[model samples]
Target: MVDRKKSPKKTRNLEESRKEILEAAFWEIFTRSFQGVSVDDIVGKTSLTKGAFYHQFPTKLDLGYALVDEVIKPMTYSRWIDPLKEYENPIEGILAQLKNLIGKAKPSELRYGCPLNNLVQEMAPVDKGFKERLENALNYWIDGMEKELKRAKEGGYLKKDVNTRQAAHFVVMAHEGFYGMLKALDDPKAFDALYDSLKRYFATIRS
Candidate 1:
């Protein structure tokens, strides 16, 4: 009789399967709110079966948690955190990253708003687990920004009186608000206005 079991090379690795599910879940949750997308919807987006999904993620909530931790956190770090290290003036780095993101944003991204902000609006209030995980992600971003802003202050790039912590929080809140406005207005012009306004805000804190 022929062997029915899959060969080692053909069998999907745990990490690969988990990553597939996370990527599918990321888009599903990004386009549709986390509460809006179902397990079937997420699985359907992937090549994997429901059994395979369950094997990788015991529960849909578990999958959501993993998505936030693995995908969203890293994305936040890359876009907002890591790039700051490349510039001596964190203010310039912040503005450059924002400009880059705005310049590259697709229509759908503007329409949908930010994924992290979307989840914060959709899931944070209703679910404690989600609220904690999402807040942790936000805090991570805030902490990174705070560190950079502190460095800027020490480097004399920011006003000596500027509170780095508050500045970081404001930057994050303003960033989220910019996306929120874009999502609500569905107009690309709003980005230019917001970008200009953010530039002005940064000017106020400059040394």
Candidate 2:
């Protein structure tokens, strides 16, 4: 029976719809390269029609930029900065935050390299827009790491000989390395090894 008055369940606004499409694009780009995906790949994840897609994102390039702006950049900021900003002991703070992620991470998630990293590696080289956006995201990562390292230095947790920039880069780089290792082996133990090794490294640098 058709209702006389159709209920307005309501739909997302432009910004909200844009965010949804970008998130779908993030997942699609993670599983495949940017060039490998299409507007259909993104809209497929949503209930909205192609009209909605074009209304929010006129091109894949617009979606790619928004993907980095919303997802990648903030994720990088959180992973590499939040611990440092919130905790007094920079080194242990970083390690503890990582362990917290391990504690909560679903077993299924352990099998993929970070979705953002996957897209960054695959799309950064092939698309100029992606390349710029990826760099913007990575810069947030590097800056966050540098901030933590600076805190460690000031707190006397690191040796004067330690180059903060280098140390920070190493930390972020090693994290990606561990995630890549996890994807290849699908072993939480590999992540365990990484956590343990970083813990030991932090112990050495502790005040």
Each candidate: RMSD = 3.4, 5.5
Alpha carbon lDDT of each predicted model:
0.89, 0.76
Give per-residue CA lDDT, model 1, range 1-207, as digits (tens).
756475554455767888899999999899988889899999999888999999988998899888888999889888998999999988899888877886468877688888899989988888888899999999999999999999999999999999999999999998899889988988878888888988898889889
- Candidate with best lDDT: 1
Q: Flag regions of model 2 displaced more than 4 Å.
A: 1-12, 31-36
Q: Evaluate residue 1 in candidate 2 and report its C-alpha lDDT on the 0 to 100 scale.
A: 88
Model 2 TM-score on a 0 to 1 scale: 0.84
lDDT score, candidate 2, position 175: 75
Per-residue CA lDDT of model 2 for 74-122, tens digit only, reads: 9767776785677767887777767777534666876656766777777
**Model number with the top TM-score:** 1
lDDT of 1 at 54: 96
| Clashes in predicted model 1 | 0
The per-residue C-alpha lDDT of model 1 at residue 49 equals 95
Clashing pairs in 2: none
